[model samples]
Target: MMVDEPPASARFVVIGGGVHGLSAAWHLAKELTASGENPNVIVLEKSQIGAGASGISGGIVRNFYRSEAMTEVIAESVAIFEDDREGFGFHQVGYLAVVPEVQREDLEAIAEHQCEVGYESELASGDSNCREYLEWLWPDVNSEGVQAVLHEKRSGWADAIGTIRNLARHAREAGVRIFEGVEVIGLGYSGAEVSEVITSGGAIGCEAVIAAPGLWAPAWWQMQGLDPLVTIGEGDSAEQRPLTEYWLAREGDYLLPGVGLAGNAGRAAPVVHFDHTAPLYSDRDGELITDQPWGIYFRMGMTGGSVVGGGLPLEMGPDFELDPYGPENPKQLAGDDLSEFFTSGLAFALKRFRGASDLWDSNPNGGVLALTPDRYPVADWTAPNVYSILDAGHGFKMLAVGREAAREILGSAKSSLLAPFRLSRFGSGATHVVSKSPYPWT
Candidate 1:
């Protein structure tokens, strides 16, 4: 459970201690134990668990996606969260995506695709229908200029820290060795294979390594001398590939009126998303219009009288870097200026938040995600014995990522499910194209 001293070696060394790392470790340990093998797994954390995006995430869980792969993985993850046995801090309230008139067709297509994939998503279109659904759920919401809404009956949000801790506890209970405050500085490569993990605490010899370093993945990949670009494959087959460049996208968040809004909307209120521009106003601030394309999401706050939401913008700027242990990390040292910007931005999207007294808390600390050319996760063997997991800031997919990674690693079953995300796909032209959704990652 707890490691007082770093073991000299391990069968598998997992880097980072956030959601993906803990989930991967727990799943790996569980599988190893079940198969009657000594699960010599070690998790090395530069800091405490949930010290990254997973800890500060808005914790939205939705099975809505344009890609079938994403939809399946998310559905699987939701099942894990709903297991009750895992003790994840999840609330299966539901998720709603509201789109503008211009995006109504896109929303319809996505909704139809979700249903085709067996997700319980409904389409409520037209001004009357959309407004009716909004009023039926949250009466205070402004639904003007809306074309349609995609409501996923099973999606919702969870407590970010609570879910991370729960996953870590499960990993510990399963006999995975977790070392806090231990950092993996470098990987000792034997030819194409990583023979050892050099850490701040000590060197750990391992047969294989899975690096889910969250925002630190870029730095780790650079340290290991692996190209940041992933090769996409031609056609649907990931077997043949061509080299391509990739980048990471930055995701940020801000809170809304939580408990108070929930009380007004009803208990366990559904998660809400907005993709249309609207006239927004506040008693303190003047009229503002929602930005085009980029949308925002909101759900009830863990505590009373507040809601939580954030900006979901596509990547367009220079790559983001982080100093996890220093003030250089935006998540660690959020300035008043950034906080004000997030609040003001959210206000432009939601009219109900105009006169609410100082109810916004932009966790100002944000993180970056590895985005493939298509903005999907890159999960596969990047090198000999080295598996890279690029989550693209998809927090809810933690459980599924760990489960699938362990399944494929143990060789008990070959998961064709993960083939689409393989590194070789980039060069093979087996890349996913951007969806019609306003959000690029979709």
Candidate 2:
């Protein structure tokens, strides 16, 4: 919120005031200050900080992933979040991922890989074992048809907006200038490198730039005359493809208002992953049958009710409405097809969530997530002096990704742990394959 002197020019400029951009600025300024260099760092935001998808994210953090790189980076991210100085309302309640018969083996392999990375996880098999574990952790949960369960002891959720604001505070303390309500309109190119960043306030000369545009990445790429992504032997090899759009899944909250529920107090509910299929019951259409299986995650003690969401991927464009918090936003307060699927499916799965559909705020609301070809983030140098910190949909990992990217930018570290997520991966055929996990961003 405070900009010291407000330098007309800075050495490093970060776009977007979300978690990733602020993290980059904070870490970069910290590294520079520690090295006695004291580089001028600036962060520009289009709207308010965390106004993008990061503000409405479920804020669940975990180290479970089929890709070794993701597993490793997320592990480091947990460490960073756990550090009290970061202070994003971090809790270590742990993450429980339940799987049915089809995903049993895949979940086991993933759990084993996670253990190898020094992340301790408990694996419970059979309905009886899973039911026992679920009851032990969450007494009210209905664990039926759960063939395998993977519990990560160290992973859990955090306060999304709180995390972003805290990171901004840290950045300011480190002498990084953050200007809110300032929109970056364009980027000035100097033949081979990005020389300046054009903004609504004014153009700022910078030596380097890190664009963490979030959902506006497609628009940013198009403005720079480059495509969001280019795949090999897909469509036209020479032509570039638009960045994939993904609608974030959101659900209602369960709240008693004055008195608190058992596991709903102090976020007592641990992060949960429901990989089992549920019977989709609709009031108007009766029991609706669909081929696609249902996968949803929820945890108790949000501002309103228990947060529940996660279904199949829905594709859309970048120009869709983004203000889910507004009173008039239909995506925020309207109960549509997606909301029906989430509420009904949740009611069928969890016994405590029987009447959650009607008790909630009537609508499911979230923001748009910029998706990549491999369904992961890309943290790499795009041009000579321009870098990108785009998180495909895993916006929660921005804390660790920002720290690593700053290390790379400061030349303190060669290639950060996220080297696997470089932009070249799509062209080199080094994409991460999605496992049977309910969340594709994992």
User: Which 10-residue span in candidate 2 carries the lowest summed lDDT?
Assistant: 256-265
Candidate 2's residue-wise lDDT over 315-343, tens digit each? 55545565443324655432466566665
**What TM-score number comes out for model 1?**
0.84
Name the top lDDT candidate. 2
Question: What is the number of residue pairs that collide in model 2?
Answer: 4
Residue 225 Cα positional deviation in candidate 1, in Å, after optimal superposition:
2.4
After superposing candidate 2 on the true structure, give the runs of residues whose Cα lies further than 4 Å from its correct spot.
1-6, 233-240, 256-267, 282-286, 289-291, 303-313, 317-328, 331-340, 355-363
**Per-candidate total of colliding backbone pairs:** 30, 4
- Pairs in clash, predicted candidate 2: 253-305, 253-306, 254-305, 254-306
> Candidate 1: global Cα-lDDT?
0.70
lDDT of all predictions? 0.70, 0.73
lDDT (10s digit) by residue, model 1, range 154-201? 788877778988898889999998888898888888888899999997
Q: After superposition, how far is residue 27 of candidate 2 from its true place, in Å?
A: 0.2
